[model samples]
Target: MERKLAAILAADIAGYSALMEVDEAGTFQRVRAGHQELLEPEIQKHNGRIFKLMGDGLLAEFGSVVDAVECAAALQRGMAERNAIGSESNPLQIRIGINFGEVIVEGEDRYGEGVNIAARLQALADPGGICVSGKVGKEVGSKLAFAFEPMGDQRLKNITEPIACYRVNFDRGSPDRVEPHLRNGYPTHKKTSIAVLPFSNMSGDPEQEYFSDGITEDIITDLSKISNLHVVARNTTFTYKGRPVKVQQVAQELGVTFLLEGSVRKVGARVRVTGQLVDGRDGSHLWAERYDRELTDIFAIQDEIAHAIIEQLKVRLLPDEKVAISATPTEDVEAYTYYLRGRQFLHMCSKSYMLLARRMFAKASEIDPDYARAHAGIALCDSVLHSWRYADVSIETILATSAKALELDPDLADAHAARGLGLQYGGQREQAAAEFKLALALDPDLHEANYFFARFFFEEGDFERAAELFEKATQVRSDDYRSAVLLTCVYLALGRRADMKRAGLLGLERAERELTLHPENSSPAQLGALALAYLGERDRAKEWAARTLAIDPDDLNAMYNIACAYLHMGEHEPALDLLEKVIPIASVHRFWWSTDPDLDPIRNHPRYKRLVERTTLASP
Candidate 1:
């Protein structure tokens, strides 16, 4: 004997006794035919096994609770449509119950209290409706597009405890219909919220994990182009990777109303993918599909899945979204895989990793020169190298690469984002803002574009707009440490003391943990120092600032922090001396010193005014 957790679906024909009394032979014949022609086939198609059938009822087992509930709803809907056409006396209807629990399996049949409870629940269900146990509702809620109205706790005859029950409602047109679109337990009618979880790697080879991960990211990028959806970025969704997650939990954590989960398996030249669209409010399956295709046609599979999900969710795909879904980077599967691998490496965020990423992108482009994403990757790599001063690549080379990427695919959001950053650093402020706006228009959920746009606004002294963009960026990538830290600065600038304190604490915690992990990196230490300075903790701020300069003496931001701390402490001589050191470096790098509100206190000082004039004239 073995025991396993499964979703138990129990259903029976409503008013079967009365119908049988009216016409025994005719009623039995119709009931049997309906089960065979409609209900049985749907159950089997949804991967449910009929364990037993007693007169006008059925007991089935399903691997997924969501599938079980969805199958039951489909069966009930079908029966409703059939009843609408028949005479009132012969009207057909079904009552369904679903529960998730462990059951004893002896041979082909399952037995236990779980099975009995499901049967009792079916009796409680209204005709053409479903009743689910509390446990089942919890697991499937947030993954399915159905409403669950609480029926309160009921005292079952043989059960010791009162069983909590919920009634499944699929009638979206009714006022009592509970909206299934909810994020973090709040109902939202807006179509702009979505979460794409990491796709399961069903590929036999463990090394091919990057391929599956890359495909998930590509789909996310395509969907984010819709602009109306608040798509959570990869960083936030990837946090649930390899973890046991319920659809509702994912929705809550990512602040998204819908969830997309899928698995990819590759066998030689052929690939298979299975995907499901789930309502994150009540754990209901909206749509599910399986695709089998040659490796060369893998892109088609992704497009088909996206289209199916959008249609099932009743989302009107914008013209841009449709175009984005249909767009193919390359026909060669190998080149696409390389491009995906490059993206994975780039996420590691290191100089060496970026160089390797560049090589892979170059290889992908060589295999297919018209692969827009690969070209964009190349442009981004070059731009990062120039920004970080990690390579001796000339500005002309960086600009030329970005231009080529844009020329190949003018609508490529990543290329636009990279070009924007390049332009901003090149002193073309208006051009940079335009490029950033274009990138956001192309992909509203592109976290980097939103973040850099906020940075651009903040640098241009538009604090209000910068704060709004920063908030949007945080929604896109909630766990982004830099964004959290930047929010602290924004709150401080706006004089929102409570928000400033909260943000400062968060930034300090993240920076301290990051520094603990990578003791050699000065970036987190510098950020921590700035956070401390903002919090008015002068001594701790000075300590971290000293540590930052000790690690990287040329770190201009750290030097600025030191000068600011002295200015705040009213140590004018020391502050003037530190500013003298930073002014020359700021001049060389064209850093925006005047726009920084941190230095406002000393702005009117003759020494500071002179230093600003000297730095601006020399740099300009």
Candidate 2:
């Protein structure tokens, strides 16, 4: 035990679980052989010490940051070369993270934040790649042949300061690889299609954005009720909220026949709302209107606009759809305001945001006891937080709140969607399906209904239906990160590798963008990592996977994704082992064990078969 400043190198096998499942004894021997013959020698060559073994990882110390960085790169290259001839049963890959700082030594043990930082960074490394803190990167920057990608300031758990990280670009010297095309050949509708961009807030106050956004969302929701008219989802159109784009460009980007542009100016008790429906083909205004109304008649104004759009688009809606469109969300303006604020927080989807949303919804409920949409908002927030492991709310709470919403307004689609999720997770599959179908029937444009129903199809092993619905969800909301990621999973299960990669890349892009704004949420990072693996960007994949693990080590959904990452990398044994870790926590995940195309390569393995059986027996 002693204390001194030093450089620490942390390394661990990538997909170790999947590798072991492919050939436990052989994989163990291979790792052991590499350690004894390759790893040990390489460390000694750089004058480093392998002082500790933590599970399937190694912790080493070097006097110089230069030595540690060099040793890490060489070890990575050597492992990649060794894996060149490796088979499915025995592929060898490792991720390394390095940091330079003072270490505390006690007897033969070394411990400190420096070591912790190195280990965390190691998790960020891709198979056959290295990650280092800013200090290590600066010290070795001028010397290494590899280029480093600055990963921005990563907020690591238990670390006081955000660490500036760099990922060693493993593909820098590798042969060129072609990336597949991302666009699907989706046909344009012969009928009317429209995208309603978020209404501009001319309220002159930026804080009034929520009101403008609420109007835009309600219009989109109402328009979506028209079965024959194709409408882009609110999430997709909101991406253009403040952007000044031409009508033609908006139409082309959304692939719609028309564009709905508008502005809302709320001044005191009176409000001014203006809207125009522009023909996509010629960028000509087909219809235009302005509504000057008191705050109490906001619902009437919304209904009038929705009706005018339908008339101009020349789409005939059935009695039910028409009724759905005109259904008032809330009669109380104050309650509606609270609901809008709650919605703003709900979409942020983090623990803190969810708490804020809960408060807002509670206020709305207190203000108007019969506000079904407000109650539904509360239920939806709690359910999502629970599902994402962002909160400890019970299924009972979700069920109770959703039921109260339905009791207040039976046809409220969001309430039904929330109830469906509650029932689905509560093991009432058939009842859940019924609820989802009813929800969609009430509001076909409801994002959650489409997403959750598509998920049902996916788990039912109906990949074709799942893909269709997931694609529908994306069509409804192009910026829907969850839909994009789940669609990637569906594509993988269909053995459509190109589609899988394309969907994954798009999902990862959107997820990363959202993560910048909501870094505390782990689902985006966890899901983004799986998407990266699908797209074969191993370096970034490892980085995101490590980030997710760092946020919440016991996040079963995230841990389940690590299993998918191993499979995407083609490490069968280690992928299975990762599943073993996930099964105890989320046994229902085993539903896809035999059917998931991602795990098809290892389904024949005896270990996988037994593990699936174990999980199945433990699940119920």
Candidate 3:
């Protein structure tokens, strides 16, 4: 019952009914000769499965989409050769539409829109030409040397969603027409934006949850690679996981034209996945499909789901979109399983989970030495652990793992981001910036790079640029308290009272919301204190700071927030006293510690100068 994507080719004779009316016996002979001499041989040669054969045409499926399209072109060219040799007749011609999509397999027959779309495409094809949906074009567009003419968007019969079409130009007189590459800018032509919600885990076992989440992330990653579409980052999308989502509301919140939601259930070696795309403007279903596949085919299933979603979005694929969507770090199911587990635990943002994630990533990389993503996961785990102040490993370990990841896959954005953070910590500022820039260039939607790079910018006393990045990071994931808290401080440093208040309230709201999620966590209390300090709530600021310190006595972030509160209360002595206590933490870096307006009351203090000097001396 597992559904797999196949290239469906629907073809029909150009004038079958008319040909039969003119000369029944002769037409039947001509058609039978074309079917046997041309169609069947080409189908067999290309490894195509002919599922249905009408008297005039046939429906075929191919595992390789490239082979299907090539076979069709070859068939046409061969038929032309026959017509040229047979001087008495105008050769019989056929119309074709090739589509790459998911097909539901019920016994020997394939069902679903995968075949239906091809049928619709066939109706649109010219007598001697082929029409390919965006779905098929994305897979074989750049792979084939044949030029394609843009057919634009067509609302075909019985198809609710308009199909973006292209015609393969094989004739010598028509020069191959190439569509202009979509340059990313404001108000892009790709008007239909979408946010794919994290797929729900329908499996009863909690451990299989990562499988569902992994599928969701893979779909998001693939969708994001399409140059035309705007896709929300994983951080923002997963916030709604396990929560009841109102599609229209989510679409409005995410500022998307569509919302994709689904569920995944894996039992033993098999999995069932269901997904639906909804139009955001009005809560109406646009496309829905179900995929049942064995566990080993998870990567292929992911590619299919991503392709299906992109097809529904009607986006013209970028030149690299096909490769990006199809790429998998490892073919080994066990290694892939371990990698998914690593990714699942990594996103939880806890030190113990991070450690577990690191171990899982190491195991995955060990099993598949060429696994680029597993190496990237290891790099991220090392960086997050150190940055979160649970530095179980040394700087060299972090550097080595990050370097190994980059060596394995220089194009991996996560590796570049991790290496950037390592270099930033190692005192190579310019090198760190270059790495961060490269990471962003590799994946502009990567929020980790934006967050870490913003920290690097903010720490160097560039409040304006730092604010810009923090704004972007928070936009990507507003519930991230660390980003909100830091953004609040950046505004404080720049002495923008109105902006500072706004950012502080944002921090306060995030911190307060997080209290419900992780009450024992110290970050919420620390952020709450900073937020209160800026809003002129001295008592609340002091209380939250005290609460944070009580939760974790070694919480330098709490101490810093307490210092900020004291500074606002005009108590220079205690602010300086708190600063002196936390100054020795090796990972702490605040160029604004001396220059920030909020810290001005303590800047002239004798202890402040010594603390700054100690940081300078300790910095590598």
Candidate 4:
């Protein structure tokens, strides 16, 4: 072997084996396509030579460290774009590490401490990030205009001195660029973000849709109980209803770190459910299983599913979360079926459906008044009715109903969530926060609680906490289009430019997809407008905004978002003009104006100040 000084590049799929197992042919095709189309071209463009390809990993050598580092960044950005539409079970993500050191080069491969160190550094990189050893950093420091964050010192497997590392922050041509902070030259930690897609209904009878949906809801509820995990809520998950979606797109739209998908089938007295846990970073299946059981053992089946997931994810179930699962309303199959039906209607989020849900919950409660879950269902329905202002019911009546449900069973997280929403709407901010906290304590997997907490944090001007909670909510339910869109706003508030761009692009893709899938829906059009605005596409943003207003003139969020778009584009006069029209409706409804970070650009403007003062006086 000939020893040579080189800039060694090491690259690997974050979760290769598991992804291949999930869909060997598909994963192989996508990964190979990415390697040939993007990675190879990038390396060549930067004057780097591919030394070898070892299964899902590769080694390359470059004469210049700057070129090697730049190539890694470009490759990752392209891969992320490609993976946006691929299957989550085999996502096209690679971790790249660069080091400047001596390597023993053979005919077609390289080896030595330099190669090993680069490989190890790849392991330390985030899914779409680059990690460079100190040697590489020092060599490129004066030559390139790249920002580096020191990760301190890392102890490699066989290296003597601690290897200092630096993370390259992706620069997309903005003066106010944000660099990723690192501890010891490596990303210190990663949040556990997950998206739980809707479970497929495979039962021969179409009427069993409710049963299958209930199973998905239960799994989501159970998973949200893990405080360490960010579970997307049912509202978000159900957005993918009746449409085929690739797992990678699901992960990107939801901004999740992981993905959970499953199918449910019921046959007469027997039910069968299959579930698989996947790593979103590279579409790897961490665990998969099928459960077969009788319909009479519905609660037991739910418990088994929850336990399997907990074990697979290695999440520690808190004592209270464990106890909540076992606290079922006896083994009454009829009552459980009624409760499931109620839950299905409740998830529909329509007034008529919720009324039907209330009747089903009443029947379940009548069958067993001591059923805490049934009471929780009633509480949820009442809260929804109150929120929608159905039949002009008093707020007091809604709160009372929610309180009764909680009184019947203090451990019912759903009841606490309902009460929290009711209290918050009734202007009891402190009590609402406390109730939300209690619900979270009772069931950490409660998506509603997490979502409300995110909103609370945003309203309190705590953008960092809001972003964290929003991220968690997305993880619990990956298909939630609203949360996915809202997260872009959170990223903007936190000044995470790369994250903002990634999220904005993901939201735009999802919104466009949704529009194509459901052409008549106005929401997606509005979301597309917001995304376009964030991306600095002023004309396109205005066009989409106009389309949204044409569909629904009274959409305050859309109206406000349009105003924000103008503000971001530096069209202050038009922005103020739109804001003047929006302030009245926002004040009347107290609709998220104070918490909207998009309005930051116009916050100090004289027009904004006058509008706020006028709205405050006009508000009741």
Q: What is the C-alpha lDDT of each candidate?
A: 0.74, 0.76, 0.75, 0.71
RMSD of 2: 20.0
Model 2 residue 272 CA deviation in Å = 6.7
- Candidate 1 structure quality by residue, lDDT tens digits, 521-541: 676776687678767888898
Ten-residue region with minimum lDDT total, candidate 4: 180-189
Q: List residue ranges in candidate 1 displaced over 4 A.
A: 1-195, 200-213, 222-244, 248-258, 262-326, 331-368, 377-396, 513-520, 538-543, 546-585, 588-611
Between prediction 1 and prediction 4, the one with superior TM-score is: 1
How close to the true structure is residue 227 of candidate 1, measured as C-alpha lDDT?
A: 49
Displacement of the residue 476 alpha carbon in candidate 2, Å: 1.0
- Order of the predicted models by lDDT, top scorer first: 2, 3, 1, 4
- Cα lDDT tens digits, model 3, 1-620, are 67999999998987576567678898899889988999899998999989999998899999998898888888888787777888545468888999999999887788888998898788667667788887666676455665444444554545668676666655443332322211211111223467888898999987788888888888887787776666666766776777887887676555456788999998988989898989877899989988888988878878887888777766777667788778777788889989989876665454455778999999999999988878878877777666556667777887788888878787989899888988887678889899998998897657788888998888876665677567656655646666777776787777676767777777788889876666776767867887787788888888887787787777665676667667766777887788777664522654545555666566777776787777677554
Name the lDDT of candidate 1: 0.74
Better of 2 and 4 by lDDT: 2
Clash list (residue pairs), candidate 3: 2-292
Which runs in model 2 stand beyond 4 Å of their true positions?
Answer: 1-195, 201-210, 220-243, 248-260, 264-327, 344-360, 382-397, 550-556, 570-585, 592-620
Residue-level lDDT tens digits of model 4 in 1-620: 58989999999886566567678898888778878999899999999989888878899999988789889888888988787866564466788888999989787778899898998788667667898887876576444555554443554435667686666766656433433232232222232556677788898766688787877877777777666555666756676767888776566555455778888888878888888888765788988888888878777877787787677767666789888666565467778889988876664333456778888998998898777778777766776565544435565776777777767777778888878877776778889888988997886556777777777767665665566566556545443344556667777767777667766776787778766755555667777887788888889988987887776676555566666566666677876777787664555433444545666776798887887788788663
TM-scores, one per candidate: 0.54, 0.56, 0.61, 0.50
Q: How many steric overlaps does candidate 3 have?
A: 1
